[model samples]
Target: MQTLNTLRSDARAIFDAALRAADPRLAVERVLARRGNHLLLNEIPIFDFTRGKLTVIGAGKAGAPMAQAVEAIVKPDDYLGAVNVKYGHLARHHAGVISNSARDGVRAPTKFILLYEAGHPLPDENTLRFTHSLLSLLEEQTENDLVLCLFSGGGSALMEYLVNGITLADLRVFTNELLRCGATIYEINTLRKHISQVKGGQIARLAQPARVVSLVLSDVLGSPLDVIASGPTAPDSSTFADCIAIVEKYHLRETFPPSIVAHYERGARGEIVETPKADDPLFARVTNVIIADNKIACDAAEREAQQRGYAVQVVSTTLQGEARELGHDIAARIKHAPTRTCVLGGGEPTVTIRGSGKGGRAQELTLAAAIEIEGDAELVVMSAGTDGTDGPTDAAGALADNTTVVRARALGMDAHTFLENNDAYHFFAALNDLIITGPTNTNVNDLMIALR
Candidate 1:
């Protein structure tokens, strides 16, 4: 039987392997192939090397890495591009190619491409500026141009072009309500798609005459393109009616920004232009493909577990719902796993922030799991975001072992009290169990691993 430390190490090993297997580098390389004169995406020739120029633009957690891969494959003189990633995501690199200067800082980017860093999970003023720049570039392209769009998670907030009538403050308040209301990614994006000019196939519209191709690293469950980063380049199936319904379902009208509500009402009433739908003509020259997602990470973790001589079980790849309650449920699943077995899962989970806590969903779930598995000596579990930062906290998540409960009790900390207060960051911090990896330069959503 494996010892407690061994289980912990094994679970982490599986996680690292999972990240490597879902490496944005590999995903981009596989989907994009350069032929003699044409650029092929999964065997479909989407760009001509000999004819038109290529304009690459993207925004996401994986933006830097994906752009680097594109630069490696394409010619420097003919490619014009840019990307918007979260801060620190591209500190060492940017849109062109990352090379260190004599001063040990990233060399300045070439004139052809610009890499801008912005906010994530929420957009700042910089996001507005960068989004407009990208839109200007795309909108200026001619019919002969090929636009390469590399997208991943975090793109939504990092790439925003506010509608003309809406104030940034109004959008901010509206976003805060959607987050606190426990809406799924789909629901949240549904509203975002209707409110923004860049999302919900507007990028495709902006790049109308140009042949556009989008390579996405999906962070949404089931790899739905329309919901990934609010489907900036793909068709939107949601409507203004759906947006109003979601707002109503969450009872957000009172606190939800009146401007946002007014926008949705106007759009629903056909007084304002709607987001491009599936039948829109803008999709004629567009191709959006998901190159990587959560299931790939889960599959890789399972393979690593089996290789390590553990009886592996792939419970689910699209886990969802509340964080703390699901923690108890996952704890029950781990408890039933036989000794020397490993369990792997992946998906985005939500935490309702009723308390003024500092932790993300990953930390909150593990804190809840700690409550259910208090005394066993050989079990260990971890729930971490693949992007390496959970919520606003520095922790990617938390780790729990059989001794976790007692250790906390000894420190005069009540796990239940913390969980209720949504203070999982402090709880795990006190126990020295918070997993900190920092910005991983990639985002495929959250991953959870359990060993028994």
Candidate 2:
């Protein structure tokens, strides 16, 4: 009863369920509510609405919708906020404009939070500008104010403020090098914390004297509070020494910008103040809460597959390592899986760029998987990011089945050649198998679904 078409459709359905579970708005709503002139987080009153002016701030792919969720609970003029998101990811309101609209049949003048679009996976001039603006807003807060930090994945790049001597160009160059070197997000963010003015709890420090609460939609596996989006509103368990170690571990000293190297070294030597540590007293007023993560998405995928009559196995939520190797391993597992089984894995995998290839981790994984499942008709694999983006590609990810490589071969494309070149985007595009879902407005790592 499990035909190829059925399996493919079921797999997509399962992934969609996972996306819904990770919806930024719903996730925020689940943890935040207002009860009788007090803002309650998880039923505990954190802010007295009558005593403080509310301000929402932070950045990420989920910033816009997360802001919307907060807006739904608070009055329009009660809070002023700003968030930087990746390009094309915005809520219903136009950027930087306040528009009036009716929600739930109530005519309300919505004070649109400043949602600035900027580059992601890499920082740009707009990233710096937005960070400065956020700092200015933070400076305006007083003890009689409430600050909510809406943070998620991509925030590290979407909201950045360089140190005194480090230029935006320097941060970009080092970031590109760190990404291509297959360094983990933790390691990359360790470096990012040292060079930025507002990361690793620095933002929390800036918003001092005001009660700061962060609602996080985590993209990092294990949802480490200090690692996700470089933990702008959390504590710093990572240090300057860790940053130098990551640079040396990746062998990026030569390629990293000179100012970056100096910055890290200076911080390590205590010439510069380190990021706020876990023991910092400033953290007493700052509370970081993760409302959604990869496990939530993977669990949702499992339930959907089960509803579809699949013997679902959520393999792992902390999936990592080399993308291609993971793909091949997944393909082998699916080959031996039972006829009506669905296997789900979720996490952000790493890809070391050895070639001038143009594909993200998800695409590369699918292409490698295709080569392994070649000529087998009973298996299908789909790997994609929840954020609707994989690396720099337009596609969320790619889909591959037994016929993927065979079809590519017919079209004069060799799977091995493309895999070797890290050109899975083009290879999948040729077969019309790329999964394009532009900016899902959320991030919880990625999901890999395989059916047999």
Candidate 3:
């Protein structure tokens, strides 16, 4: 059996490799080099942009790096602007506008502006400002322009512009409630699209005559174009009625803003404009490509495990559900697997916060797995966000071993209580199990690996 420390190291290395493989820069370059300015439809370049004014506009955790990669390929004159990335993720060429000084002989456009960095998992004033700026940019586009949209995870919160009647404060409250309720990304995004002016095909409509090419780094389980970043560039299959249904189903009708309610009601009655459908003319020239996804990350992890001389099995790249329950399931699987085997799973999970404890899904999963795993088989389970941030915390996620339970017991702590309180951050912090890799500048959901 491998030593506990060796297993822990292996888990960390595998997780890091997975994240690097799904890096926006790598994926964007790989896809762009193969199919230049042309839109690759099912591995075939269907729409070639040999002569057109290329304008870049997108928002997400990976927006900066993805933009940087695209910038390397396209001329500086062709680039427009992008927003809402962690600090310092932009390339040297684009750093002048974002930074205190200039570099790479590339000047940040005086017309293009990135408003500000806002809170993650929660939309704040900065989110509102940046979103409005994006909308303003979209409104300026002409029929002759070609828009290259780079989208990844975290764009939902990053691109936050509410409809005329809704306020950012109302959105903040509703988002907190939805997150605490453990709402899925699809459901949350459905509601977000209803209240936002730029989401749910609104951007696509705004860029009406302009041909749009969306290059996406998939952080979602299944790379549904309409679901990623709430499908700002793609056609929206959902409607305001769908949003109302979700709120009603979750018993959040009473808690949501009256404006949100009224807007949906009007939408249902055909008083308000609905999201553009798949067959809409707006998407006649639009193209969406999933350049990378969770599968890429999981596959990279598997390869790393094999290189390290461990038998590897990728359990699933579409793993989802309650964080704690998923932890137990993974632990059970590890217990049954061979001593030299490494089990891996990728995809985001939900945390229904009942307690006032501070924690993200990955931290909670690691904590839960810690409680269930106990043996001398030298098992180490680690969970991390591929974006390098787990919820609003500073740590990427958490790591634990078979001795984690014993360690907690010795510290007079209760793992079940921590899990119940959604205090995985504190629980892992106390044990010094938090994995911190500040702003990886890429996102592909969450990754979990258990080494035996």
Candidate 4:
């Protein structure tokens, strides 16, 4: 008899395989290569070092390793700039980052670019500072320059520059409102572009005349270029009217600050310029390449599941909707699924917070699934973020087998009460069921796995 513990281990191994496939450094390395006096991305000659000065800039959770990938191809002396990453994401690249002050009056010679740690899920003080640093670097570039931009999940918050009249405080509040209302990443980023000077192709406009190449690791479902990191280097298909429509759809105007409401209103009235459109000549110099995404992660999971001796089924690559709802749907599927089978899924899910609870979409979904599949010995389900951090909690997500509820009850814990409070973190913590892989240093979205 195969125990749930064994199933859980297999599921975790499969998840780990998915993370390895989505590694930001490896993803960039696969597409980027160097040749004698020339550079190639995906085997096409894209850059020539002798033509101009090379400047690298970007923002994301994977920024540090992506920078390391670029460094592997471009000499540190040949390129210089900065990238804003979420706080504590600079894994093992401490020697490569330029610090604020030199303790010994000598900076590391290998340090050509600056990596500034900033707040995430929302922009903070360091976000503003790093944005200023990157813009100033762009200001020094001329027609004979090459700008390489790295982007991945979390870049929207890791990098930001507010448009005039919209304060950081207002932007933070507006972002929180959008998140709590279950707004999609596309809609949230659409609104972000309107209020930020550096997003929605504005960065490309700023780097004009200089050729810009952006290597993206997509976290959004469907990988719409304009929505990722609010399309800092891609054309914006969304408009101010789109922003207004999103607000009206969510009834967010009432909760939003006056400045936010006024800014988009002015933008719609032609008082402010819209984000760069697809026809904009500025985009002629920009190239956005997706190096990795959820599909790649899910495919890896499928292969691993097969290697583990389970019949595999890829459920979906574009999964969406509310977390709790998706949880129930997944549980029902697993219960009806054939024995010795592994069902794999990938996509970002939304969590609409109704209580003062500490949990992300992945954990919330797993909790709901646990309740639905309680008392069934033939199923085990796990959902986790590839980035290794779910929402604000330290745990990436959670793993629940048929034994989950029973184990919780033995410890005097109730799944329904925790679910009601949106407190999945504590619920899983008590049972030691949380999948805690701290900062896998990459993001392609989330992965859901079930085995029976």
For each candidate in turn, the TM-score is 0.95, 0.95, 0.91, 0.96
lDDT of 4 by residue, 158-268 (tens): 888898888889978987897789999998899999999989999999998898999999999999999888899999999999989998999998999999999999989
The candidate 1 region of ten consecutive residues with least summed lDDT is 101-110
Please give the clash total of every predicted structure, in order: 0, 0, 0, 0
CA lDDT of 426 in candidate 2? 91
What are the per-model C-alpha RMSD values against the true structure?
2.9, 3.6, 3.5, 2.3
lDDT, candidate 3, equals: 0.79
Model 4 clash pairs are: none
lDDT of each: 0.83, 0.86, 0.79, 0.87
Residue runs of model 4 more than 4 Å from their true location after superposition? 93-110
Residue by residue across 369-397, what tens digits does model 2's lDDT show? 98899988678999999999999899999
The residue-level lDDT of candidate 2 at 26 comes to 93
lDDT of 3 by residue, 230-320 (tens): 8888888888778778888888878877777788889888888887889888888888889899999999999999999889878888989
lDDT of 2: 0.86
How many pairs in model 2 have backbone atoms within 3 A of each other, for residues 3 or more apart or on separate chains, i.e. clashes? 0
Cα deviation of 207 in candidate 1 (Å)?
A: 0.4
